[model samples]
Target: MMQRCFSLLFGMLAWSAAIALEAPAESHPGARAFAAELARDPLAIEQGLSEAAILATLDQARYQQTIIDAISRPAESKAWKDYRPIFLTDKRINDGVAFYRAHADLLQRLEKEFGVPASIIVTIIGVETSYGRITGKYRVLDALTTLAFYYPARAPFFQGELKQLFLLHGTRFPYATTELMGSYAGAMGWGQFMPSSIAKFARDEDSDGKIDLWNSISDICASVANYFTAHGWQTGGPVAVRANVDKNARVITPGSLEPVYPLTQLEEWGYHLGSNPGGAKPDGQTPVTLLQLEGAEGTEFWIVFQNFYVISRYNRSPLYSMAVLQLSEAITRELSKPAQ
Candidate 1:
């Protein structure tokens, strides 16, 4: 009886080992790698996130093929003619005016405090999320995890953002990492700021003791203004102006979007001031750059000033900066006119 009992115990032990071997792996290799990296940080371990828990979170992240496809075709890739109408529509302009009027007191206070224009602030929010109506729906964790591990194009950047998300949740944010939602790139809230941007620029404008950008208009507007001011947005400065190019003018394409030349040098290069001009020509020393955009009628030219460069700092695309500038101008014009 004793021999038989020992034999049954050994068989049960062997079966348990076999079942363990047959079980599927719980974590992906990419997730394991990220988990290992995260475990190396003492703070992450201190935050009560065990390696197993981190791996579980990563395992739940679904790789989004749609996000991969969308990342390849950003609006910034479109030509100015194709891009302008996307953001500068009558609806967007009208909505921006309404949003401005609705939040005029807060906006005026932001403009006074930050030295940034209220119209520009409204235009940024309008262009980013359609006046806070269409903030993205994708889970930020899945987006950042997929992009950080699977998408190789900007993996390092996304990885840093993923780390920032962890740090943000660990430090001040009260929600779970999986609970936050944003763009395919993980840009969150009305301003569509990345996790790193939130960590650095998000503010509790309402003094509610927590930064609630997702629902707080005051926080959203103030955060947007803070980001712009932090990026060196000039107060009461010209953004851009239309320019008349000589029919036979040489097309001087700048290698970068940065303001590399002065207005005097651009005039020497055959770009003359054109219709609906903004500020007067500055002294020969003020830096400016010539911008060429494809219009429906023909090629369009513009002289972009320092403020234009500042706007580009928010989004490195000239088209995006132009769209925001034009939209802001439209809203300002509509607001200036008498209400019918």
Candidate 2:
């Protein structure tokens, strides 16, 4: 629903407003007074969200230097030559194996309950936070507040997320004072969910009253599965498949999310699919996109399926989606190996 809303709103009028929310003064009488005013005029509460005072507060919030630093150092800067070595290290792979083993039961449960593969779930966690070893250190509130109020490109989306976070604070999705730290983009937990995702899909796997994203492995695991399930994950379907395409065939560039043509069309266009079902194309015949990722040997290519598109919903970058898929395959292969 939010996705549709975003798509519709993207083409509409662009509001010119500074995007950051001012950090609430600690127990400031002004904040209390504002809160009381909002409580009294429910309409004001709705309108106050975008009121001049609120926008002023948001604009007045200082830029967090740490957030600026973290967002700048995306893993892709080192090129695939260096980046592949970082994520595909024997240490990281072995650690992933251990993580899978330790959470075998929960992983199995998520697969059974959510119909999303455990390998995919675990791979997402691994790729995002090294299997929960490092889930960022910035305070989520500051991050969301900063991005929502200051980042003009995606301010409305982040502002909605900030609203969701505050709402979560008062609901079943309670948080501890210390554990509410996450990415500078305000994504939380092992799967790095934005606040809206957390509010809508986060589940309490341990049946605890709280749906804590930090430090609670069960909740985090469950939340990951829940997100996949909510976002149209197809159980046991291919996430992606290796494909061979002629140079004359259709070329897929980065950031292409639209499914324009049929599989039969792709075949006529000189693209050869590796997996055919009963000498016929797969059901739905959903259009496939060729994604090229730089690897150690050379350019690696794959035909991404609808499920792969679903993965893109989590992180829009083609590189990120490809990395997550490769990580999943790698972990699954390592798990299938003979035990020592």
Best by lDDT: 1
Among residues 3 or more apart in sequence or in different chains, the pairs in candidate 2 whose N, CA or C atoms overlap within 3 Å are: 19-149, 19-150, 20-58, 20-149, 20-150, 21-58, 22-57, 22-58
**What lDDT tens digits, residue by residue, belong to model 1 across residues 100-125?**
99999999999999999999989999
Clashes of each: 0, 8
- Quote the RMSD, in angstroms, for model 1: 8.6
Give candidate 2's whole-model lDDT.
Answer: 0.70
For each candidate in the order shown, give its overall lDDT on alpha carbons.
0.84, 0.70
Which runs in model 1 stand beyond 4 Å of their true positions? 1-28, 41-50, 275-277
Q: Write the per-residue lDDT of candidate 2 for residues 1-340, one digit (tens) a residue.
A: 9999997787453432122223343223333443343344554465344345443443333446566566667776655655766666677677778889999998998899999888888888888888888887777767866665456667778767765665555446657423478888888888898888987888888987888777788898888888888888878766666667788876656468444556566677666677652134565477676666677788766667777888888887666776777777788889999998
Clashes of 1: 0
CA shift of 50, model 1, Å: 4.3
TM-score of 1: 0.87
